[model samples]
Target: MTSASSAGPRRVVVVRHAETVDNAARIWQGHKDTELSERGRAQVQAAAPHLAAYAPSLIVSSDLRRAAATAEAIAGLTGLEVRLDPRLREVHVGEWQGLHADEVRERYPEVVAALDRGEDAPRGVTGETMAQVAHRAGTALREISDELEAGETAVVVAHGVSARVAVSDLVGLDQDVSDAVFRGLGNCHWIELVEAGKSYSEATRWRISGWNLGPWNV
Candidate 1:
């Protein structure tokens, strides 16, 4: 585990997209580009004031509709344009994309069990490995952090699984052990990562200052 230190960026708030219809149905929506549900829109709207209090200088989002919509809500509040990045998208679930959680559990009990036990399991035959998602998203976040001047902040709206993986990597957890330390973010929830140093080199250190913050938390 990385030690908590006051060294990194002023703050990097990474948010999970708001709820969607798939979420309401407990369906696996990885990379499926579902739009926000009515509750999702409300969640985003409710979170806007708290997010605005963070005073983020920039907003970045996955190009997927759910994430994009959430980012747009915050952007509307902050008057910041959202920069879209497909690399910030969710993990692709391949054959399991539209399956409900119970259905997946029944069909792939062992795989689901492994995941519940904090072990890595395949999402599907052609889906991305967690390590791959972590690498790409982590790299993107590093680039974003590298560009920020001191005391600047940015909000990154992404999906639950990818956000957890990226944050685990950012804090120096290896992929194998990442799950033990990082848990999934709830819809419209966010985590704040603070840099442990001013530099953004490969060896940069970070500490999670906040986790799973949302309107409810406020």
Candidate 2:
């Protein structure tokens, strides 16, 4: 349980990958390596300039195509290299992958309800638990932060659920209460985090200075 205050850069900007075909169709992607849709590309393009204004010291992204593409757009704008990390990938949904939202709702209402309540939803065979995803995401973020200098900002481009979980973990929101504390980020939307204190035992040592800042608004 490494805390955000224990070891890391002082700041981070986390962004959700642009939309994909699966996103528009309400289908589960779950590490399926889907590409960005045309609209997704445009969304990335729209966001690049706004993100570049941050002058991120590093740009990190999930290895999945959609996230990679989004990171690439920002990299091109900022002239920073994109570092791909598989650990930042979305939660593996296993049996739920490729299923429509309605299908999942009808087939796994209880699991869906659990997710809505920020509880550990049952991962079907071969899938990952939310706790598993959060652990990996937190570890990856810590590693990236460790490589950064204090006050330097790193932009992390990842999937929606993974980004939310990472932010929740960084802010020390309990897993069972995370849903009440955070909301899903829209495509190309981002949140900003800043270091507030130095105690690993205190979750309040980190602060979310910004939430869900969309490119259109910028």
TM-score of each: 0.87, 0.87
> What tens digits encode model 2's per-residue C-alpha lDDT throughout 33-84?
8878889989988898888888899999999999999999999988899999
Q: Relative to the unseen true structure, what is the C-alpha lDDT of residue 56 in candidate 1, on a scale of 0 to 100? A: 91
- Give candidate 1's error at residue 161 in angstroms: 0.6
lDDT of 1 by residue, 66-88 (tens): 99999998999888999999999
The residue ranges of model 2 lying beyond 4 angstroms of the native Cα positions read 1-9, 113-118, 198-204
Collision count of model 2: 0
RMSD to the hidden true structure, all candidates: 4.2, 4.0
Candidate lDDT (C-alpha), each: 0.83, 0.83
Candidate 1 global CA lDDT score: 0.83
TM-score, predicted candidate 2 vs. hidden true structure: 0.87
Q: With candidate 2 superimposed using the best TM-score fit, by how many Å does residue 15's alpha carbon deviate from the native? A: 0.6
